[model samples]
Target chain A: MWQKLYTWLDERLGLGDMYANLLDRPEPKGNWWNTLGSASLFLFILQGATGIFLTVYYTPSPDHAYDSITYIMNDVAFGWLIRGIHHWGASLMVLVVFIHMVRVFVTASYKYPRELTWLIGVGLLLLTLGMGFTGYLLPWHQMAYWATTVGTQIAGSVPFLGEFILKALRGGPDLSALTLQRFFSAHIWMLPALLAGLIGVHLYLIIRHGESHFPDEED
Target chain B: MSGSHLSRRDFMKAATGAVGGVITAALGIPVIGFLIAPALREDKAGAPIAVGKLEDIPVGKFHPFSFTITKVNGWERTASNYGGFILRNSEAPDDILILSSRCTHLSCTVNWNESANAFLCPCHDAKFGPEGQVLDGPPPEPLGHFEYSVDDQGVLTIVPVELKSEA
Candidate 1:
């Protein structure tokens, strides 16, 4: 039964073989640029862990939110550090993810068998950027407030669906306390969960598909 | 440069080249630093802050007394806008209320109306009962409160709270 469970899990993840193959194969031996990808993963992990700690004390209500943040930053043990990790880690992830995408593009690794992997990678990249943007406003400070208010207003500027997307984001015609609550919930849960699943699929695709040949492959 | 003559050793060197030398020092260090800066920064949270004199606050009137706070939020240093309000009680000599200027409705500025005996929101005509309860207008709920203290010097001090806005 245990063997069966292992097999079932192995069949789903297949990550061990994927790692073996990637290492045995030379293309993924990787270079300094590849560290950015590794760094990105590290940042993601940092975000998730610190985010959990933050949730322990975070009050999502509009009334208590700013104070909750103040509590986290000032009152809690290393609260500011936790928030900083979550904050800076997010920006770092965004930067590295973009650099990874650019590397893939310049190398033309997006072609052929890697197309699916690249597509998922691009999707994940966009998701990372969205995550950064959404999380920025969570602090609910003067900058976060006005910036997000302007951002939502920009979204509402789109023809037809503008108001819809804006309303969906803000949870109202005018930005309200509800808007803050909704964004907070989605930032901590919805977007992260989606990114996690997508990242898993992305990793699986990379493992199965293997690394694309670099431009120097023939040389 | 021949297509067929590359050795595994040469390939390995080429592969790791991007992760080595100048690039490692120039990019890797900063990348790590940037990612970790937030966690590395310290905060002055829980540190008691001193505000203004309790005697200076005139009876039956509100005065805005602000305290300078040293705050470390993630990688940035934020110094201003920490103390927005330190409302002195109408009748009590030392009673003070620290109300967030933000309206409960949309986090806009709310001022104390001595005549109306309420907090008035200029953004949407919202009114709050003297104690920060919602009285009339668009504010979804009562206005918020800031943790406050009257110090030994009789200074009214308020801890700065984050302003809430449309998510």
Candidate 2:
């Protein structure tokens, strides 16, 4: 019965062909280092899932934001676990992606035909940092507020355009309700959308070129 | 056309269509509901919040007032607190003016300078007079005001309206 179902679907959807062409690609001898890219991908998906669960409870305003987070931590069922995972997951994702990039760099995987993949990896790294920065401000606590103040001020210090950049980031001079709203939107929607798109391209590039092997002494 | 004449392929196709339709409806309805639920929600900003007694605000002085107003954003209902100042003219005690502490220039909370007799924005040195007029500095216009009313009990009630930067 299972074989019949599989054959029927495979005949219509070309699943057999797809599996053979895509999943059966050759790779260099697999090692622990080879798992970083997949680990980064897994962590990203975990972040997205936990983040969605969080958005159900997290209110993104200056007033209730911190209180809502506190409620999620204390009141909701398994909320502490979820929030803890998300909070730590963000840091872990960043660390993993950075290490993956470092591995790629040391292996000289960015050379030859895989330069675009390296560039996309860089974009992904930046997006991950952007996600971290924006997500940090969603809680609207004293630490988040002051950290954002200092962070945005650094952006504001950029020569002639510093003030404009600062105002753009904060949605005003000092962090206020608008700043919270802006950061929330960017964190939840804009950055995620960009990250998703870039991740798609990054994955496509990886599949297109196949995973680069560990550098051999001959080359 | 016989009652038991259904072939294996025909039976599978019928089952697939029924399952597909059911799955599609099951998934699509919730997605559509999630997309439209926010629009359908009644976004109530809550009733007018009582700040304080009218007489408590001394004449010729700007008193800071803060109140939490329940703001409904989509499905999430959260209480957002806001800050403003109640200014009474030195000579005209009856004429009470309420101004939002948020500066028009950049939305920073402006502080009332007793020495300068002006509302000073620490971010950019923008100043506004006791009457909420722009005194000097970067602010293009005066501070915005919140609509308020004094009840029979002498308590001041302010309707937390949208913060308009335009005067």
Every model's DockQ, to 2 decimals? 0.03, 0.02
Docking outcome class, model 1: incorrect
Cα lDDT tens digits, model 2, B34-102, are: 334344544444468789987677876678988765654433566766798887775343578899887
Q: Give me the runs in candidate 2 sitting further than 4 Å from their true place.
A: B1-167
> What lDDT score belongs to each candidate, Candidate 1 first?
0.71, 0.81
Residues A1-219 of candidate 2 have per-residue lDDT tens digits of 999999999999999788667766788776787789988987888788778878877888777899888777765556676788789999999999999988899889899899999998899999999999999988888899999999999999999999999999999888999999999899889988998998899888878889888778888
For model 1, the superposed segments whose C-alpha errors exceed 4 Å read A1-29, A217-219, B1-167
What proportion of the true contacts does each candidate reproduce?
Answer: 0.00, 0.00
- Local error of candidate 1 at residue A184 (angstroms): 1.2
What TM-score, computed on C-alpha atoms, does each candidate reach? Answer: 0.53, 0.57
Docking level for model 2: incorrect
Task: Kindly list the interface RMSD, in angstroms, of each predicted candidate in the order they appear.
Answer: 9.6, 7.7
